[model samples]
Target: MADVRLFPRLAAVHARRLLANPGISTGVDPDALRSAAEPFVTWAPSGGRRSTNAELDRLRDNIRAVAAACGWPGPAGQVSRASFDAGMGAFLLESGYLPVAEALRDDVWSWIAIALVPDVCLWRFEGAAPERFLGGRRNTLQRLWSRARVFDRGPGEEDRWELLDRLTEDAMVQITERPSIGADPKLAAAIGEAWVRTAAEVGASAMEALTREAVRNLRITNEVLCFGALGDADLAAAVGEHFQRAAAATASQTGQASG
Candidate 1:
């Protein structure tokens, strides 16, 4: 691995100032922002060859293009928000720079959120919580990257990323928000695949309940058993069974409510 760039731990106060800065207008000039933030950014600590300004500019240009395609700065983002999020996640993860260790650095993410793509962050969140701007649990891009990493079906599969677009927000949360389930990409993907299958069988109405139940069961199973030992097909089957049971439980509850 090589060293990557890291931005300082910018406080919420400063984050608010720049994110709310009206003078910059719709989008930001990466070079100008880079110059302003350069005094604070460093490359000594993280992995991957030292990040260059040129590499960073290329990344910025790619992300900007992706946003444009998704209709950023327009009403299209309102309707295609998920698409944009998934696209950004895929691009960031696939972009060659972020290794696991470097990817975990909140400073790096903060820099990206604060200086590199403040324009997108502001427009996307539209005055959401501070964590969305910072690099922690709810940080916009970080969370999306985590989710994309978890749900990605891996190389060689024709539609590997299909799960990224298929699962509902709530369904994604069931796997992603909980550390017990989200930490393991293989397990997460297995559960995601089961969720899609279960949705097809039981319909959308039961999915939310089924997802909750399935995740609950998986958490318990993970505590007692080694999920890592299981083969992909076996793991998917096991998760599918949990979802089946969840579907039954939800159906019974619905029947009781009707009665």
Candidate 2:
């Protein structure tokens, strides 16, 4: 892991008003900074300024369109990327946008992130062993290692694909709870209930425990980045366990207070 720690002090959001126009940088809310830095990251291939705050509604519409095209249910709330891999693969096969290998690679990472943040049950590959399944559910978190293709790489080509899968449901809750991202409030409430129940099962608190868990996970992520062990595929998984624990704890506290 890298020596970088994920603490509020270490992660400061720095706004830049110097460029003919103002911008942000790699401090304080680094993700926000990264959002601003996207231009610099892709400066060479770009010819125009990026669009402003894209907003949640647009993202929602896009998701809905994609979902509908794939025969997914209307009004996407929290669909499993892994479970729908077969449909996606079939869709890709029909579309033929890129090479088969590249398409597969992209699909694997995309689904992994979906699995990490939201609960997912990966579909099985054809002709695989039967025992490697959870009631017909294959390529699950427990059986992630069984699917080596997701992480395999040639020399000099880093294998960060494995980072997409997290072992908790916090990521899913986080997405569902986001107020700006077209989240369903009703689903959020249900998620809160589930979170509280899970937290109570482990006896957790909302204050120090939940926040501290976030802090620790960020630190661990910083360590991973610093050591050059970080890969895009695995970037979000570091906070998986911490997010689940914290969300559960907070949900539990909120539930008790409301009750």
Candidate 3:
């Protein structure tokens, strides 16, 4: 993947305003939007040799295909939404279409969300916050990319991305909302895997409590501990222990101990 072309912040803001315009529910035509977006595309700092917009086609087509199974947008079913997210996450990470460094830019993501696949974003989020359409942590696509990159089980494992499907949105929010855990892939995956195992053992009812406690505990511990320095087994064990303790506390509070 070469350097990415960015859509200007001004264009992203204008695109967001379009959502309020009546009849936006029908969705914007991607080709037309792409043509309109051309003037706003920026190559400041020389975006490395006349980049092509072919990836935009792939993104638009993938949105239709993925959204089709998910009830064609307009607030799809939860299961389908999650499935769609996982599919897109895999696409972003595996498609070889974007460089990781370039993908990190909020404006580049804004272009994709607004100009490339506004229909899908509008369909998925509907009346949700503006950030979902813009970029940054809450952007619909950016979060999925983060999830896939963070939870991938790595090269040697079969179905390396299984962890992405395992996480529920609430559990994810607890991790992603806190920069201490979400920014570090190894740490985030450790916490995610630990959350999954602990939730299973403690039952789903305790998951909310377990994650809350675990995130809080980890945040404080991370100030003194360097989880990044640990080996895989050690990291998992540490994360697992933290979750177990959180689960135990939750069980005690609710009077439903797993052990």
Q: Find the candidate with the highest lDDT and give its number.
A: 3
TM-score of 3: 0.85
* Order of models, best TM-score first: 3, 1, 2
Mark the 10 consecutive residues where model 1 has the least summed lDDT: 1-10
Model 1, stretches more than 4 Å misplaced?
1-36, 45-48, 76-78
Best by TM-score: 3
Residues 67-111, model 1: lDDT tens digits: 888887676554577788778777777665566666777766777
Clashes of 3: 0
Report lDDT per candidate.
Answer: 0.74, 0.32, 0.75
Write one digit per residue (lDDT tens) for candidate 3, span 20-94: 555545556766665666666664365544445565575568767877777775557778788888777877787
> Mind giving the per-residue lDDT tens digits that candidate 2 earns over 105-169?
32232222221211111122222222222111232322232222222222354422222232123
Q: After superposition, how far is residue 253 of candidate 1 from its true place, in Å?
A: 1.7
Q: By TM-score, is 2 or 3 better?
A: 3
